[model samples]
Target: MTTDELIAPGTTGPATPTRRGSLRPLLLRLHFYLGVFVGPFIFVAAFSGLLYIFTPQLERAIYAHELTVPVGQAKQPLNDQVQAAQRALPDATMVRVRPGDADEATTQVIFSRSDLAPSHWLTAYVDPYTSQVRGTLETYGSSQAGPVRTWIDELHRGLHLGDFGRLYSELAASWLWVVVLGGLVLWWGRRRPAKGKGRRRLLSWHATTGTWVAIVLLFLSATGLTWSQYAGDTITDLRAALSWQTPTLPAASGHGGHGAHSEHAGPSGPAVAATADQVRNIARRAGLDGPIEIAVPSEPGAAHVVKQIRTEWPTKVDSAAIDATTGQVLATLRFDDYPLGAKLARWGIDAHMGVLFGLPNQIVLAAVCVAVLALIVWGYRMWWHRRPTKGGFGVGRPFPRGAWRSVPTPVLIGLIAVTAVLAWYLPVLGVSLIGFLLVDSAVGWAKGGPAVPARR
Candidate 1:
């Protein structure tokens, strides 16, 4: 049976009355408009995210020569590896070093290029056992992501258009939850299925699939928003003001001695402070084990910051600060001591990136991405089938004039308050919402009333 047959005659229009005082119609209008307008950006994000989760496999295959080595009889000292990396890049300054995760893995000796941006660095993969320089590659950002992973990550975040393009992603994330919840309400209030399956099947599939992925979609939207540029900063500042910031070792204040500028010195230069071996000893005393990251001190009296992050479920994130010259442990912070907000932020980011549960996490997130793509495709298909033959493509209908007047006063007030808060919380989303409302109001005024569908 057709959808037209399934929906009652008068109920097909936006002004149709219900117990909820036209709430369903308003939500339907919102759902339809957001889906039609925002669906493309969501599709791009999901597709790029799908590609990003496989980065581990892609990196392993593409960089095997640089990342792997045969298990050798004895491992070389950390400083020896650093010296080897320095010999390879004679002019570059040492940045940090990452211990290999396993016997067959190569240690990373990172170096900063004076000519490049501060965030850009070159990483030399050195065999831990033989101190042999395997290869070197330039990386970007704090995570030091390689060329391929960086490219994919940038595409996912900003389509490689930089900060300005980031708004597209933030916009998609902000509206995602609204569209999902609105979809749920519309599906629940939909008419009963007609006698035989036909056009009704489209609605059925769309609703069913939407319901199936609704919870996961919400989770993704919330977590994705936390990483957005503008919204993320607001969230961080809010959390900090609430005393929810993650605890970390305090920086050393006064310059303890000479060699404070060791980080700026070339690899061939004299040791400015404590050697890598001494810093490693200090980190060991602070209970950091397994693959660790040591950031070289960049200034006098600065501490050598050491961090260990395990990518499995129940992640182990711990860090310590060691006095660069004295090789004394300055401070240590463990994951178990993180505040509630900090823990949530850490776990959410890791899970979103498919690192929280290891391979299983990656597989599940990849499936979600696939489902999102499918949902977007089906949504567009439904819209295309329902679009009017004459007019340019648009959301089919909007609530009738003054339809909002029937909404309960309290509910209306609550919505307005929430909208105001959201706008304040995420300025970009707020601006976009205001723009949408302005355009919607202008069109309604120009047309003499809110636009309503021509009933089939």
Candidate 2:
């Protein structure tokens, strides 16, 4: 068939067929089907991720009262701040303390109660200088995000559906790269721009915007998949087996030799080990800086662990362990010692969150998000405009029978093998892919066998 003949009426086209005529049609079929069936989930994921990247600003404004205080003369001791926080939540057991980095910031004393799960804890913010409790709020997991950020994060991750909802995000993330790459192929295969107005204009816009944001979209997809519930575990295991886990400081050989001792001192025990203030001093003396977190020892002979994670580009992640009783530094790990894979993982996650390069990173992420939203909107417009009034939800006409035979045998086998491996790596994507294929087959059978082109 000639290129002119392939162009649909009223649509612009340099619909030139490439050398791999058979392969091009197959790719077009896949792209059209995925777009029609899977696009909504992608839209949701993109929208949620866009909102998540602005968490810093959202949190600052929402938590202003508890997170900030007036600059004052010499701050009170860390012990005093802890005491104030204790007074506010006497039933809670102290877990960690974070003395704010600036004079205007509030010190955070984190606590856990018997009723709360490990991931759910309470944080009491206290003014360091006055040792007065500013406020108390609930936070979750290792990220330690406040209530508002926690809600938004959960929404982004699982739509508040818990584990089941998580599948949606993961599935969306897994298929995103495929959808993007297929779109790129289709756009590239079309040698000439579609001419005319209406659907043609919409297609042109969709193709142009998609090409512009393809690279960014790919980055977003990769980083996003790293956090997916199922696929994420696969990635973690793969990285660990490859020796790519984040590095940590090693404990000094004799530091905890006194044998595990209880963190709390009894009336007869060695005078109440070192105070919280002493532990903080030990961390500082050990070379730790920039918004460090001091985890109080929970058991006897346990060392106080202090960690600092600064997400700015050239990211800094370091940790130290101190003997709780003697206030002596026991071990330390610096970001510079991390392996290449570990470093890349850190950088990728930080960049994904829009914090790696500070303001510029946020700007770039925001622009990509906006562009994605526009592309999705334009895509739907194109689909809507081109729908067949008489057909059952026009998802593009199918290719002719015997089209599969046109693809070379080796190429077909290779594609199947790749798909199988991907399915193994990402179960949700694999299952969804199979489900779509089955549904398409059933529909074709119902329509009296696979649709054959009247004239191709």
Candidate 3:
């Protein structure tokens, strides 16, 4: 029979001779199962993602005073700034020093103190010239920024489980691709519902919103996955590109052999604190604009690393690394210095946050967010509409006979496999989904069929 003859009139699509079979049902089944499994993560990611999108505004609102310092005269040398910061925060490790600027003229020396977990960490900002403490912000709910950012971070990861949390976030991020693709399939079914009728209107609404959201969802899913999967390796590559080398520690000296042991003891010693002019010149020669952060050498023979986030208007980016004892710029790196892969990694964050300026990008992201929200609502509606009249939890449709009957089982199996992979990375989420999977399987078996209708 012809394709048109096979398709019943006023139906959604042109019908096939038999039915669209093979991997389609299996894929749809997996999609549904995984969606239910990762539903909470998607919800959290969406909510937290919305918050993160406006983080700059959040910072401005919450930490107004802390983010600003009084304008002042010339600041002290880099060495003096480090000393001043150390004096105020004796036990803290001085990471880097940010120089003075026009509006916020005070120099800030950042120091961090480690605790049980890195989240239990603190950043101290010290003024250089006056040797006074400016302010401090902790990683989790510091005064500068409150519990909002903290909560967002926790939700973004896995509630402060540290490495495990990051792993969970990564898995969620990776599997988001499935959510985007499933959403597309579901969207495809929404178009041209019924001629000049309410069903058609609803379907048209869904289709329009879905089309807009599909693009942005794909954009975020792709970039977010890349960010989670490759950010660390990209950072490592960037560090390597800057020619950072770790000198091997000397072998333990025999009790009597001081002279031979001294040969491999390393570089002569850390040089005396350099002058302000020398430091400034070093920064200038290194091509760093805005504030340059100088990290004090912790021990003898250690090279000082000058780090800086160049926040000049229109170019809010970063640059950094090790310098020679004589103030000669040794290894260095700019944001532009990143290799193609690393550059893509940096761009991913900008894209994920919709900060890339052009109107099209912003409009697309906003539309995507709206689309996701609609999908969540409509998907729930579809589930509600399909509820069984016979008091069973299965979808309100019959399973197609023959091969289609076997589709849901294998789809369930594939979903389980995908869930297993996702869970291995995010233990808590994995465990939670396992519980969900069991309940889902129990309900499916009790109902004696797949929950949703299979297209025939």
Model 3, 361: alpha-carbon shift in Å? 7.2
Q: Is candidate 1 or candidate 3 better by TM-score?
A: 1
Residue pairs with colliding backbones in model 2 are 12-194, 12-195, 261-300, 261-301, 262-300, 313-356
Per-residue lDDT of 158-208 in model 2, one digit per residue for the tens? Answer: 999989999988988898899899888877777687766776777777878
Model 2 misplaced regions, further than 4 Å: 1-7, 10-21, 252-274, 389-403, 453-456
Error of 3 at 371 (Å): 3.5
Q: Estimate the lDDT of model 2.
A: 0.75
Q: Write the per-residue lDDT of candidate 1 for residues 120-232, one digit (tens) a residue.
A: 77889999999999999987765667889988998999999988989999999999998889888777766664233433566677778888989988999999998898899
- Tell me the number of clashing residue pairs for each predicted model: 2, 6, 1
Cα-lDDT of candidate 1: 0.75
lDDT of each: 0.75, 0.75, 0.51
lDDT of 3 by residue, 307-426 (tens): 454322243344333344566555555565545655554555567765665445555665666566666665444434444445555542311223344345667577668767656654
